[model samples]
Target: MQIEQQAAIVTGGASGLGAATARALAARGAKVAVLDRNADGAAALAREIGADGQAIGIGCDITDTASVLAALDAARAAHGSARLLLNVAGIGTAKRIVGKDGAPAPLEDFERVVRVNLVGTYNVTRLVVAEMVKLAPLADGERGVVVNTASVAAFDGQVGQEAYAASKGGIVGMTLPLARDLAQFGVRVCTIAPGLFLTPLMAELPQAVQESLAASIPFPKRLGKPEEFAQLAAAIIENPALNGEVIRLDGALRLPPR
Candidate 1:
């Protein structure tokens, strides 16, 4: 799509890959709505890309239906109908189903992870996709595209990552089915499974742990950058033919069993 005339909604837009993607989309002339729990950060990003009135920020909680509906409305108010949807809000934690302290991992914690990473992605996509289906198609009869965030843990989760891995795996598993369901409407769905990236969580690791993680990648020998992720997102937006696939942005890294 010629991005200038396009409108996009990005969840988790307050920071990391989502923030980079919002900037990249704006740079390419797409109007963007930044949806995030961090209102201050989202508002700041919106102001940064005020040119052509292309960006706005909305406070959102992806796991809540009412919050999501309000945020979608806010996006439409700023950018008209959304043609691009990026699902990037998720949480990660490491706990075995059976913990070392003889206490089983709480079901609530597992449910929370699934709620934000799996159900949350589904919530925003379903809401925004309804709008996309209503939009007039591009020259190729394409109405919209969706990019969802998964994690390499889904495939090669280290020990103690049961909840996180399951959540991301669900995200990955939904891609193909969603694509098929949305095909008639020309809305493509894809997922990205990232390895160790230079995101906030990884950055907080001890230097030694971080270094060990970087060394595990087969090539590149470093952490993935948020901009690289944004680059892939831009490509997915531009290429209508790419759909129903989960692409890994892990620098050829298959994690080891912890």
Candidate 2:
């Protein structure tokens, strides 16, 4: 689908990759709804994007049905039904199945990660797609497109990453199936599994730690950029043929089990 003038919803739009995506979509002339749990940040970014009404920031919790419904309603009211949905809101945690003390990991920790990362994604997608299918198809017979965010850890999880990996792996596992399910409704689904990138959380680490992480990438020898992820997401939205695939933005790096 062409992004220009289309309504787009980006979860986690307060900061990091989601914020970058909101900016990219707005830059491409899409009427953007920046949805995030960080209400202040979201509103700030929306203000930064424009006060001329090209963008709106909404506080939303993707995991909650009521919150998502209200957010979708607000976005539709502001910009019309969204044709582009970016599922970028997620959380991560690192907990080993067996800890240093030899006690089992907390089930609540595992549940929290999956609830936010996996279930939250599906929650927003289903709500968005439900509305998407109601819209008439465009000239290319496409009603909408969805892009989900995963992590390279889904493929090669390291020590103490069972919860994180399982959550992301669920996303990776659902890409093709979701595409198939949505194909009949003229909506396409795809996922991006990104390796280490210089996100806000990553930036909080020491310089030496950051550099060590950067060196792990096989090529370019630097961390991925949020803009780079936004570029691929835009490409996927514009390219109708790139459906049901999980493209890793890892610079040909396969992680080691640390």
Best by lDDT: 2
TM-score of each: 0.97, 0.99
Full-model lDDT for every candidate: 0.90, 0.94
Candidate no. 2 TM-score = 0.99
Query: What TM-score number comes out for model 1?
Result: 0.97
| Ten-residue region with minimum lDDT total, candidate 2 | 45-54
Please give, for residues 159-253, the per-residue lDDT of candidate 2 as tens digits.
99998999999999999999999999899999999998889999999999999989988897999999899999999999999999999999998
Clashing pairs in 2: none
Writing each residue's lDDT as its tens digit, candidate 1 over 75-123 gives 8887788988999888889988988889988999999999999999999
Off by over 4 Å in 2: none
User: Best TM-score goes to which candidate?
Assistant: 2
Which pairs of residues collide in model 1? none
| lDDT for 49 (candidate 2) | 83
